[model samples]
Target: MTTPTDFLLWVRGPGFDIALVVFILGVIIRLLEVLVLGRKHDYSEPRGGELGPGLKTVVTRTLPETGSFKRAPFTVIGGYIWHIGFFISLFLFVPHIELINATLGLSWPGIASNLVDAVAAVTIVTLIAMLFSRLTHPVKRYLSGPEDYLTWLVTFLPMLTGYLAYHRMIDPYPLVLGLHILSVEVLMIVFPFTKLMHAFTFFIARWYNGAMSGRRGVQS
Candidate 1:
């Protein structure tokens, strides 16, 4: 049987290192495009206001009252939960935490293993629910593009494979581990080119909306 130490060594080797590099670079490039190219348009325009009106009102409104939260409550809630849960699982998973500790000399306190496992389970279920809602809800269905479906698959595969790998449900750790890594690698390579780009764009978009509303003296 391959020991955990051997598995860790594999993760620390060239394949994992290259995948990490690609993920980081992809995210950075995507963010630059969103910040630089996405800013060329005048977001103060009426059409732009439709994209995020509550953001526009941020300067005048208390943070809690941002209409964005109210306008599309379910979408916002689901999105937030999925993102937070995904990030927590990604960073807190034992192997990842160990890697960070080893490579960067940093470690975050983590929840108990069982609790963390529960959270991962919840995250996966919530994400699946969210994807289903997007497909079934008329308004969401109308708004979703092909890229949306693709993104869901790309994101789902990694979480699912990671869970399977961690649980060791099917013996042969190598196969499950390889699947998890492959899913992640695919996600990393495609990140900058898909709707997943929103992860980087959302903050910039919010700030732009806020600035525009402030400049126009309009209640956001």
Candidate 2:
């Protein structure tokens, strides 16, 4: 029988290595594909500078208009809350910061662990609410597919497991920590191939849209 210690070792070592390789390769290949499938060259004369408008759009498009937010307050608010929570949980936690420093030789101070724990808890709750909304809202439910649920599952697991691990809620500490690490590895492996790729590509997409509009002398 594989003991919890054994599982922990596997996930912390070989599992992490495999996930890292897959994440790097998958992201690189996807980026290359996007680059190779470049947009058609425009021959039209430029009416204004493309750089300024492109950068401006990148900033502007980050938040929706007031009217749009008012119409979809739950989505807008929930989205921001979870997004910020995820960022803090991922980048501001001491253990995660240590991991990043070990991986990239970059180090930064992390916030209090209690604060991270609270954020993770809130993020999990927000995700649940989002899921409920998706399931109940007719238009959202109609538009959602297996991919949507799968992404949500993968995203939620890490937060849930990490919170459990940190609190030592499970009987076997190593087992819960191992599960948390494994869940994170699963997320990393799935990230490059799924909508999670938006973390990286959203900026590229926004920049492209802005640049095109700028070239046409219009706001994106």
Q: All candidates' lDDT scores?
A: 0.74, 0.93
lDDT of model 1 at position 68? 80
- Model 2: how far is 118 from its true place, Å? 1.1
**Per-prediction TM-score:** 0.73, 0.97
**lDDT by residue for model 2 (52-144), tens:** 887887789888889989989999999999999999999999999998898899999999999999999999999999999999999999999
Best candidate per lDDT, number?
2
TM-score of 1: 0.73
Weakest lDDT window of 10 consecutive positions for candidate 1? 56-65
Error of 2 at 20 (Å): 1.0
Number of the predicted model whose TM-score against the real structure is largest: 2
